[model samples]
Target: MQRRARTYLTGVALAVMLSGGLTACTGSPEDEGGEDTKAGSSGAPDSSAPPGRYRTLPEPCGAVDLSTLKKLLPDAEGAPQGSSTPGKGTASGDEESPYEGQPIATYDTDRRAGCRWKSTNSLATRNLTVDFERVVSYDPAVSDDEQAQLLYDERAGQAEIPTESEPPADEEGGEGGDPADEGGKSGSGGSGEDGGSEAADSGTDGKGGGEGGGDPGGEGEKSDSGGGSDASEEPGGEPSPSSDADLSPRTLDDIGDNAYIDDQLDTGDSGVHRDITLVFRSANVIATVTYDQWLTDKRRTPDSAELQEKARSVAEELAADFDDN
Candidate 1:
C-alpha cells in the first residue's frame, strides 16, 4: 500500500509541471507574433523618400539620327566617309566662336573604338571643345529653329521667360495727349475712354493722364519697331533662304576637343571594306558614332545598303541617351 501511494504522488507532480509549462507557452503567443509584425514593418523602405528621378542628366546624351543629320548638314565634297565637313573640323577647335558663346560642332574620338572589330577614327580632328555638354541628335527634317528650341529645352535648369508682362503707364494727361506724361504726352481733361482712344491712335499720349496714362498700344508699336530693326540688322537680313548652313560632306579634322565617344557600329558589306564616321557637337557636349563596312574598289554607288542599315540601327539605339556598356 505504501509503495502504490508514493507512485501516485510522483504522477501528480509530473502532470502539474507539464500543465504549468503549457500555460507559459500559450500565454506568450500574442507577444511573439506582435514582435515579429513590428520587425517586418520596421524593415520596409521609407514611404516619404523622394523617387530619385533627378539623378540623371537633364537632357539625354549620345543620341543621333543619321538621315536627319545628313539632310541638315550635307557632308562637304571629298568629305571622309562620315558627316563632318573638311575645314569645319578645325572650326570647333579654333578660337573663333562658331556659335555665339559656344564651341563649333565636332565629332568624338575616344579610347572605346580600338581594333576589336574593323575600323577606328577620332572626332578630335573636328576640334569640338566644350566641357560637360552632351551630344543629342534629332531628325534633320526638324526646322533649325525647332531644333534649337528642342536643344534649349533639354538642358536642365534653363528657364524660359514668360513674354507677357504689364504694359508701361503714361504719367501726364489721361492716356493719349499728355505732354507732361513720362512716356510721352498726356491729354487735357478727356474722358478715360477718349484718353485710351487717343493713346491708341497716337501711340503715346502726353503726361498727367489718369490711371490709364501711357498708351497701351504704344508698347506694341515700340515692340514692332524693335523687332523690325532686329530683322533688318540680321546678317543678310530677311531670314536666310536656307536655314541649313552649308550642308556638305565633312572630314575628320572638323570636330572639337570636348568630343567623347557616343556610339559605334560595324556596317557595310560583310566582305567589302568601308568606314563612315558621324560626329555631333551639341551644346557643351561632343560625341561620335562610327560605322564600318567592307567597301569594294569597283565603281559603285556609295554603300547605301550597309550605311542605311547601320544608320537605322544607330537611330534606334541612340535616339535616347544610353547607358555605357
Candidate 2:
C-alpha cells in the first residue's frame, strides 16, 4: 500500500511539470505582440522611425547657425579658437595672446595651408565641434593710429583695413598745364612798360605786402604767377579718402615665417608635440586639432605678436572648417 502511494505521487509531480512547460510555450495574447501591447497599455501612440539622413536628428543640417554655437560655448581656454578675431580669447590658460582686431573672412599662409571662413547650419549628430589656428603676420599698411590702438587692444589692432580707408591709390597727373597758367600769361604780355609803373602804383596802394610794397605790379606778378608755377610743379596726390580704414590681410610669409616658428617653439627641454584627435560617430567623422600643444610651446617661451597671430589664425581656420561633411 506504501509503494502504490509513492508511484501515484511521483506521476502527479511529472504531470504538474509538463503542464508548466506547456503554459510557458503559449503566453497571453498581449505577450504575442510585445510592442503593440506596450503601446496600447501605455496610452502613447506609436511613433514611426525617423527619416533617412535628417530623420535621425531633431532638425536638418545647418539648423544651428555659427553665432548660436558661439553663444552656447564660452570663450575659455581649451575652447575652440578661430582666425576671425584679432587677439586670442580667454580659454584655458592665461590670456597672454589677446585678440585685438576685426575678424578676417579668409587668408592663406603657406602653399599647403590656406584658410577659408564659412558658417554652417547642418549637423549629423546633435553635437558639433570645431577647432582652428590663427594665422599671424605683420601688416605694412596699418596706420600709426591703428598701431597705437593695437598696443592697447590686440584684437582690434590686428584688423585688416579696407581698401576705401587705406592710403589712396598713388596717382600721377598728366603733363597738361593748369588753367590759371593762361591768366598769368595774359597779364604778363598785355602790358610791358605799364607793368613797372603799375607795379609801383600797386605797391603804394597796397596796405601790406611788407618789403615788396615798393613794386606793386612786380609783387603781384611774383606772388600770383609764382603761385601758379608752384602749383603746377606739385605732383598728383593720393587717391580720394577711403570708406574702409581696415588693413589688408597678411600671411606668415608676409609677416616673416621665422616669427611664426619662434612663437611655436619650446624653450624647455621638452620636445615639441601636437595634440589632435579623430572623432567618429554613427553618422559622421571628424578630425579635431587642439591648441594644447601650442600652449605647451608657449610655456617654454613667449611668441611674438606675429607668431601669435598666425597660431590664432590657424586655429580659427580649422574651427571654421571643423565640419567637412
Candidate 3:
C-alpha cells in the first residue's frame, strides 16, 4: 500500500510541472511569429529588380538609311582610301561604298555596336557614325533603366555641354530680339497679333488696352532698348559680322527620353571641322549620332547650324524607328 501511494504522488507532481512548462511556452519568443522581424524564405522582401526594356539592340550599320547617308556623306569623287580623313582608317583595303557603312567591331553585339561612313568631295569631307548601347544592371536591387540613366547622366556631364539654364549665344549679353528683328519697324509698337497693329490704339480702350500703361509704343521701345541697338549692325548701319548662340551645345527637349546636342568647331592643324553629336536614351538603350564635316577651305568655318540640323534629323528618324519597332 505504501509503495503504490508514493507512485501516485510522483505522477501528480510530474503532471503539474508539465502544465506550467506548456503555459510558459505559449507566450515565448518562438510563439510570437506575427511580431518577429527576422527574414526567412517566405518572409524576406524580394531582391530581384525589374528587367530592362530592351532585350537586343538595333543593327548599328543600318541605323541610318541610305538617303541619310547620301545626305551626310560626299556623293561623288570621294578621296582615295587611306586619305586625310582623321577618323577614317588608312588601311590599304578596297574602296568602301559610301552607301554601305562599315560595322564597328565588338565582341558582344548584344551590349553595344556602331558603324562609320565617310565620304569626301571638293567642298568638304563628311564622316558620320552611329552607335547603340544597351545597359544591364549588375545589382539586383537596381533596374536596368535606372542603371542606364545613371550612366547617361555621367556621360552628359563629361561632355561639358552647357546646362539648359545657361543663356544661349544670342542671349549672353542682353535678352532681346535678334538682329533681324531690329531692322523692322517692330520698335514702334508692342508685339503685334495683327499686322495692322490692332493693339496700338486698343490700349486707349479700357477693355482691350495694354495691361499697365495704355501706350503700346512705349512697350516696343522698352523691348528695343533692352536689346540695345542691333548687334549685327554697326554705328553707321554697316552690316557687321554676327555670331549667334543658337549654335552652342545645349540640351534638346524632344529627341528621346533624355537628349542633348554637342556642337564643337575644332580649328586644328588638320583643318576647320565641326562635329555635332546627338545623344539620347530610351528605356535601357542609348543612341549616339556623331556627324563630322571637315571643310576643305580652312579659312571658312563649317556651318554649325547646318551640322546641328542634320544631326538632329538623323536622331529623330532613329528614335521614330525605335518606337515603330
Candidate 4:
C-alpha cells in the first residue's frame, strides 16, 4: 500500500508540470486575436510606382521588313538569320550560313537588339544595320513622357542636333519683324513709278552734258545696289552662318516622335565610303538605322536622299512593329 501511494503522488506531480508547460506554450486569446488583427489590417501593398511604357522589344533581325532589307542591301547574299542559333563553324554545327546576313547579337534581347547585312559587288559594296532599344524609366516620381524626353535630349546631344526649346523671345520678336518690313519696303520701292521717273529724268539731264557726270553717278548707285543685293541674298541678310551639314548633325522633322541624322565620310586609298546614321524615337523605343556604301570611284559618294529615304522607311516599319506589339 505504501509503494502504490508513492507512485500515485509522483504521477500527480508529473501531470501538474505538463499542464503548466502547455499553458506557457499557448498564449492568451487576446494576444492571438491581436496578431490576427494586425495581419488582416496590413492591406494591399504600395503601388505608386510609375510603370514603364515598353515592356518588351521586337525581334532584332525581323524588326525591319524583308522587302526593305532587300532594297537596302540589294547585293546581300541572302535573307537575314538570327544570332540565337550558333553559326556553322561552331562545334554545334548550327553556325549561321554564309548566305544568312550578319546578326548583331546582344546580351539582353528584351532591352536591345540589332542586325546587319552586307553585299559586295565587283567595284562597290553596301551595308545596312538596324538596332532597336527599349527605354525603361526607374524613377517612380517621373512620368513616361518626361523620362523619354530626358533620354531623347541625351541622344540629341550626342548627335549634336537641336533640342526642343523655345527660341528667345527677343530674337523672335526682332527677327520676325525684320523680314516682313524689308519685303514691304522692297515691294513699295519697286511699285513706285514716280521715283523711277525722277531717276530717269536726272539721268537724261546728266547725259545731255558731254562730260557724262550722270553715268558715273548711276554706276555708283548700281554698284551700291548690287552689294546690298548680295548681302540680302546671304542667309538672313546678315553675314552668312556656317552650314551645319558637315560640321553638325541634322534634325529631321515629321519622322517619328523625334529624329536626327548623322553623316560621316571616310576616304582611303581604295575608295571613299559614306555612312549615314539615322535615329528616331517613338514612344519609349528608339530605332537606329545605319546605311553605308563604298564607291570605288573616288569622285562618287553615296546619295544622301536615297540613304535617308531607305533609313526612314526602315524606321517607320520598326515603329509600326512596336505599335503592333
Candidate 3, residue 298: CA error in Å?
Answer: 1.6
Order of quality (TM-score)? 3, 4, 1, 2
Output the TM-score of candidate 2. Answer: 0.17
Number of the predicted model whose lDDT against the real structure is largest: 3
Alpha-carbon RMSD to native, per candidate: 23.2, 32.0, 18.2, 22.3
Put down candidate 1 lDDT per residue, 155-242, tens digits, no spaces: 1001111111212344333546544463322222222222233223211111111111122122111000001121122222223133
Model 4 clashes, total count: 6
Root-mean-square deviation of candidate 1: 23.2
TM-score of each model, paired residue for residue? 0.25, 0.17, 0.60, 0.54
- 3-77, model 4: which lDDT tens digit per residue? 999999999999999999888777677688899887766642232345666777766655555556656655454
Sorted by lDDT, highest first, which candidate order results? 3, 4, 1, 2
Off by over 4 Å in 4: 1-49, 78-100, 166-249, 268-271
**lDDT tens string, model 3, 1-325?**
9999999999999999999999888868666774565545444457777899889988876677666655555442254442222223222456544455667666789987777666665566667777787888888887888777666655554455444323344544344566534532222222212212211121112111111112222221100001112211211112222334465666788977888787666566656566667888888887888776666566665665556767788899889888776
What is the C-alpha local distance difference test score of candidate 2? 0.26
Worst 10-residue lDDT window for candidate 2 reads 220-229
